[model samples]
Target: MHDLIVSPFLDGFLAVRPGSPACVRLPTDLYEEVRAGADNTVPAWLVQTAADAWSLDLDGKAARSALLVREPTELAFARASWEINLYCNFGCKHCYLGERPLAGLSWDDKVKLIDIFRDSGVLWLQITGGEPTVDPDFEGAYRYAYRQGMMLTVSTNASRLWKPDLLRLFRDCPPYRVVVSMYGATEESFDELTQRKGAWKNFRKLMAAARNAALPLRVSIVVTDDNAHEVDAMKAVVQGWGLDHHVYTNMQPTFSGEGDPLLVQSTEFLRKRPVFEGCNAGVTFFHADPHAKVSICKIGRDDQIDLMTEGIDGLRRLGEISDRLMLRTGGCTGCSLSGSCRVCRPLAKVYQEAKAPLGMYCQHGDTKEMVHP
Candidate 1:
């Protein structure tokens, strides 16, 4: 029920609103004072500051319902992404998930998982799936995470964005952002790409509803051989809606090392990725699959920690796991171009396992031939 959350962030303390991006960093002493202060009571100065920062009319004696102060923890995480379920209504050939199964934690277990995220100090949580919005317990899980004071982002296909219940939930408690994937600019191409009829109609409704509700929406233009021809048209459509968008040109093999998804790659639209600089991954962030199995990152699923059994304490091993995963061993060992490799070790391993063409991910491939003029 709190409107503001003050929690330990990295080496400092940060104050953030649940649905908003604006954050205020508090000094260590101030954070300690807030934590040690009487229950439901915040400093008068903070109350005034919060009111001004978020434009809320806070009482002089800030109640616990208005402000939440989380105790400091040994956990270093500030962000995490969870796959609530792996089910989807549309079957896109380029999907990396490959198989779409309706499986996830129970509602009771889901509540526990959300609590674990809070206890582990996850501030920014992304709710994703084959299609997150279509999950049966999506509403319950989303609401619980929101109430727990985690800033959320939902990744979806926008097929169900126009649903009345979903609209009401988002209107009441907006997500940090709703990231929708754009398959095509026209109905025919859209349905063709998703292999689902009426998908375009649903997408149009989703856009209109989101615009009318004034929701924070961003688009991911997914370019594949099927929809590559509509790339410009897709951008124009999103631009007309006055929404921000990012183009995703590269397609990868499926998580299970299947090369089928690679076949759909739009070589003309493919963009070169930057060199792989080390990422925080398991150090500061981790990914949880539908079964609550934790991995350093989405691509590196080896040596997973079962959150359901190990609980939050399980995250302790992630740092070491991350270090080991980043090592240039296995298929990457003795490679001369490792320094300039665009993909991470884990992703490269996936490509190697699938026997994917070097042209798809390796710099040794002819870049000039792949890039469009």
Candidate 2:
């Protein structure tokens, strides 16, 4: 049977034989319809293809392996993300970690953190930061995780991926993938958004070095109003470079409690999405911030407790707290739009109130239209 991999947010998917190089990134519309399943609008051939590969009946009624939702906390948490620190060398105007005193778990503390994740049954680790490359202890941390047999997924700006120390270390202990965030298409637009001179040059340098070494690299372009004009150009450039990439439009609230959607894309550009229903966060997947605060996800930071103080049972204890905080208030519960509403408690906190539909609702009237990958 073939294995299907679908991203809930990125609007892309890959279907491949689990251990072989046989894979295809399905077209967006086909992926969406297959993900939609019963309520799919596509022709029967597409659904039939998906079912045959995933070993489902021709009707496509059976849940796709990629779409199956796993429940439970500690016992099932094989995927987790660790925000090493919110420190970065470059200044991006749209950063959620906005200008804060750099604070993070020390080397020993981080090692302990890694152990905690492993003990909690984590098998896939996501290493992210304001820029993970900026951390001195990153190599040690990465090595420790690697030795534990956890598949690593790193997020970086590609600024220091070319360093002899890092290149050698990662070359020896390679991650499953490394994602580089692209700010803009041109040097001028790059500097305009990132506010760093010569950063464009540095990025190119790292790119060249990485290409020469043949590193497993992918690109993620943060779609924003400022760089909207260059989105096509950026995608073209990355594609021309023989890179696989995806574009994300959401600009979340700042880490400083500033509910500013500063870098949000224009309404015309953002794909209309249905209100989010369930998430993998906290249940099967989780997030650990720089200060050891464990939360459901990045946007769910405010709803989290301190991991160091709360211990491994942090999420278990936070159940009641989440229940209480998730109670619908204001016009949301009473409004007819509540059922179709895509805004959840975590994202709701980003605005002045929980009520949404600010034209952000899904294009299709039903929740089935929601694209996972």
Of the candidates shown, which would achieve the greatest lDDT relative to the real structure? 1
Give every collision pair in model 2.
8-372, 11-373, 12-373, 273-362, 275-342, 276-342
lDDT for model 1 comes to 0.87
Best by TM-score: 1
Model 1, 87-127: lDDT tens digits are 99999988989888999999999999999898888888999
Please give, for residues 143-181, the per-residue lDDT of candidate 2 as tens digits: 887765466788998889779988887677666788899
Model 1 alpha-carbon drift over 4 Å, by segment: 38-42, 59-61, 366-373
lDDT, each prediction: 0.87, 0.66
Candidate 2 stretches with Cα past 4 Å from truth are 1-74, 259-264, 318-327, 353-373
